[model samples]
Target chain A: MKGVVFVKLSEFVEETWGLALWDELLQEADLASDGIYTTVCVYDDQEFFSLVSLIGNKKGITVAQAQKAFGEWIFTELYAIAPPGAHDFVDIFEFLHGVQNVIHVEVKKLNPDGLLPEFDFLFESEKTLRFHYKSPRKLCYFCEGLIYGLSKHVNQEVTVSHVECEHNNDDRCVLEVSKVG
Target chain B: MDKNPPPEALDIQLLKRKIEREQKARQIAEQQLEVHSREIYQTNLSLKKSLDYAKKKNAEIEYLTKASYDVSSELTLFDILQSTVALTGRFFNAAHGINAIFDGQKVQPNSKPLIWSSGGFWDQNIELQSFFFKHFPLERAGAPPEWLIMPIDENDRIEGQSFRWIVCINFELGNDSSVWIGFLSKSELIDEEALNVLEIAKGHLRSGIRRRLSDARTVRRNIELQETATHLEDARKQLIQSERMASLGELAAGVAHEINNPIGYIRANLQVLDDYLKEFKSTFKLIEEKVNLTGSLSKQEFTDTANKQDLNFLLEDAESILKSNLEGVERVKEIVEGLKSFSHAGDDNLKQISIYECVGTALRVVANEFKYQHQIINELEKTLPNILSNYGQLQQVFVNLLINSAHSMPDGGTLKIYSELSGKNLLIHVEDTGVGMDEQTKNQIFNPFFTTKPVGKGTGLGLSVTYAILEAQHISIVVDSTLGKGTCFTLGFTVD
Candidate 1:
């Protein structure tokens, strides 16, 4: 797991639930970092799972649902921080495309040991793009939320559909995107 | 009240179930949003690559336009190659380069490569040229592609040198004319954009070579046309001169014939008048004798009549005057005949005749000119075979030579005419023992309008016309002379 993910999760929790709930989630997670994170550092994947699970249990929602909500909330938070090599694109599509190449390349330079997912894209049409998401973490739902957040930032309406999911016995997650409005 | 209220507990359980369903729905929605973001990100990466490729291609095209303009502006091969090298270096960031022409032969190892380099000439290791020819084999293949890029080994570098790349391009200018441009640089590797630019530069070099060759061909053709025009103009002038000389010969022959007829009658009438006067003197002397026998007239009267008539002086001078008059007419007749022969020689038929015999005939024709002052010697080669030649023209040439030989000596001298067979040629030599010409005079002796004779006494055309005649017959003449010694004119005629 990357420290950026942990830091984004903490911000989302504190903003949506409140400071007390964030402290409670940190105490429950028992991370060695004690819930503190820097975007350039790497963290254990187990810590991220523990925090998501605690949030789900306290909110009476499933762990998968918590991760998806976190995905959506974290994108808006990441934009606010506006790190170098990010938030410089004019279009949602441009921003989204930079995630794997430009933005993630910068990320690896900052945190070389962090695990990053592989994304392979096939442009389906003028208004549609499709990609296969591969990672052992199976965070396809989180990727879906990031797409929506980007579209919202650019004030464009788009649909993100799951063609296949790793949970359904697929080797990799596949997603499709199309402009709706 | 009980520890837990029944109504509140039921309401809390219902609220938890509703929230669970709503949360599951929200999860699905958020997942879709994430998927779309990833898809757009992937697409943008692909688009960026495409955009970069397009930009690179556009820049290459621009380089091609500029290179083409620079190269084609020059009209010579070396100029074209120099410009090509400069542009290629600039485009590829090359430090040194060679633009060579191999003449499509087996390249020699020691041969120097034609090059234009930024840092001045470095003795390129001969191994490099050999290696280039070995791989490219431009001898068999006229051109080595329009564009090529490859790496030069760092280990192949000369002492302290650091270039690591080589790019070669070929331009075929037709007729096995080809130019090769090779660029060398210290850069580690050339990118695809620079390679693409090299391809376009190759195109520019090709057209530049083609245009220069075309211009050179045009210039050569123009020179040939001008030469042909000059030759035609020269031939026209020669034709006009020939026609004028032909007409002058006809007029001279006509005048000689007309003068010869009158000279013939004048000599005969003068002889008849001399004979009749001698008869009259004899009859007068006999009548005087008969009168003296009869004693009819006094001696004094007879003597007075004889003296008044001047009979003795008339008797002495009458025969002498007639003989001198006849000799004058004969000399005029001989000169008229010589003029006629010389002028009408153009009409004489060609035949196989001994060149020696022609010299004999010429000696007789001009015997009068030499008989007075010079001894004529004939050393004709008797073993010489007959040659096919114009008899009258050969005679004329010999006659002119004999006359010139006679005029050389005011005092008596020897004139020797001889002939020999040398190879396939008949060589005739005319030697004179009279005053020869100086070096300056000998050089211009064969030129028209050049004569040693006082003006009006000579036309200066004798030797000049003889030269023209021999030249027309493909005969060569050489005059060897030394002042105060003698002149020898050697005529060589090819005999087949």
Candidate 2:
């Protein structure tokens, strides 16, 4: 069956882990699909473990053990299903390509309408992004939907893949995506 | 062999299709995540911006509250205005500010609003306008900037019945605009409060002005009252002096007449005695010559000489001198008695007194006043009847007239006092041949305080008091005087 999976985390545990854990986790992990593991760890700490047990009534582990398990899982299970730009190297390349297309098509469409489009998005790894578009309404409509879809997926707390687009203003076909966990 | 290769190629195609589907799903999730991250970042930025703005707003409110508190602290009108202008200037960052108050008629911009601000900033020629307008050329003109023109209104109405006021506030450094505050009522500017500071100030100004005006009026009225009181006091003193003089004049006149009668009889008697003494001396001389011729004469001859000399006649002449001196003494006594009666008449009842007797009594009292100055000529009619009157006051009136007559005759002259019996009335006249009064003097002669004599000599109240006395007794006195000739004062009384 094809379906989406969702998980609600404790807000307190998420805040306690903060942005520092995300940065360190992203830097050290080797995210590649080798089919050697099954589960991935997002945040780990003694406080987070206790907080999770209180909220979910699950077993707990120390931060050091969870960090080692998260690194091993990223290289195997999480990478297995991730798209082409799931890792940093592919994600940066896809994002630059997507930004160029968005800027060109939206600016061309918005020049006649005298409106600037603004938007916000979130990744599955709890990373936020913002943008202001000096763009036209027709192009901004698609960008707005795409950014909204990305924020919805991030709310589900899952990993994502990155991709680039081939279409410009003349063509309505474009492919742009980035991975976050 | 061909069938086995076909199945393997089909399996590879299915796997490629599945991988494409999974990659597309992953791309969708990544886009959603990026969008959510951007939204959170934008929300955080907006929240920070709003918090900063609120902090600044609170600071501005605090500053305004402190400024208003300081402005209301002053109590006096001038101080309040000054502080209001100063605080408003500081708040708006203006250079110079001025408050001009109105007088009733016109706006005196240059004049200091109070006596205390004598040396303060005062500017004239400030005018009221609908709005503060900058003088700009038509080419550069557009919709002008808005100016703050707050009018100080007393009764919530502003228009024709408004006070004249003009306030000019200069711009601060690097600014070119100014704010103007004015009032519709002069009184509305008091106490520096929003409700009616100007009105209270105007009220104070009006009260101050009114107080000054009333003070001046009171001072003028007091001066007038004092002058009137002094005049009244002087009149009273003169009245008293005149009455005393009149009594003195009456006494002098009466004594003069009495002494004249006695002196006249004594002179007559002395002349007769002188003649008798001359005759006796001649007879004695003859006897002496006869005795010398016949040396030893007989006693019979001496007896003949004594009989010839008439010794009884000499004794009779000596008795006559003694009798005449006694008569002179009696005449003096009569004069004294008449004076005493006239003076004491004030204690007696108002009765029907003979007109002749009244005249004589008055003459006796004023005998000394007219002693040598004038000769009194009485032309009293024998048929003159008595009149019902206050004897003392009537005597005083008579005496005043007679004395006035004597005074008129500075040099010796004849004073004629006469009476005529008319129907039910007796008209008595006292006339003097002396320097008479002119028309002007005569008109005011009976007016109290009107005097023709030198100061300190005559109090001029004599005739006036005399007129009053006679009038009180229901009698009338009329005077007729010819300048450089003589005067006649006529008294008319009703007979019982």
What are the lDDT scores of the predictions, listed in order? 0.70, 0.52
**Local accuracy of candidate 1 as per-residue lDDT tens digits, B86-188:** 7667666777667666556544334456554675554565655554554453654474555666676656665676767667777665666556777767787
Question: With candidate 1 superimposed using the best TM-score fit, by how many Å does residue A114's alpha carbon deviate from the native?
Answer: 50
Single out the weakest 10-residue window by summed lDDT for candidate 2 chain B: B170-179
Report the Cα lDDT for candidate 2.
0.52
**TM-scores, chain A, per candidate:** 0.85, 0.20
DockQ scores for all the models shown?
0.02, 0.01
- Give TM per candidate: 0.32, 0.32
Question: Candidate 1: where are CA atoms >4 Å away?
Answer: A1-181, B1-75, B108-111, B120-140, B143-145, B153-162, B173-177, B195-197, B230-234, B241-255, B259-496
Docking band of candidate 2:
incorrect
* lDDT of candidate 2 over B1-496, digit per residue (tens): 5756675575565445435534654665566567768977998899889997776555445445544454444344345455555444443333334543433223234644321112333344233222122211112112222222354345533344444222332211112211223322233342233223233333333343334445657889999999998997566445544575556663564477668778888888888778778777877787788889997556887777767887667868778797988889877876777666655534324687777787887776677677565788998865678788866667767777887777788778999988777788878888889899899988999997787777766657777878766765778888899998999888888877
Q: What's the CA RMSD for each of the models?
A: 24.0, 30.4
- Put down candidate 2 lDDT per residue, A1-181, tens digits, no spaces: 0111011121222344543332233233422321111122122223333332232322265433333333322233323444443333323323433444554354445244323343323222224333333333223333433343333433432222222212233432222333355
How far residue A54's Cα lies from its native spot in candidate 2, in Å, is: 99
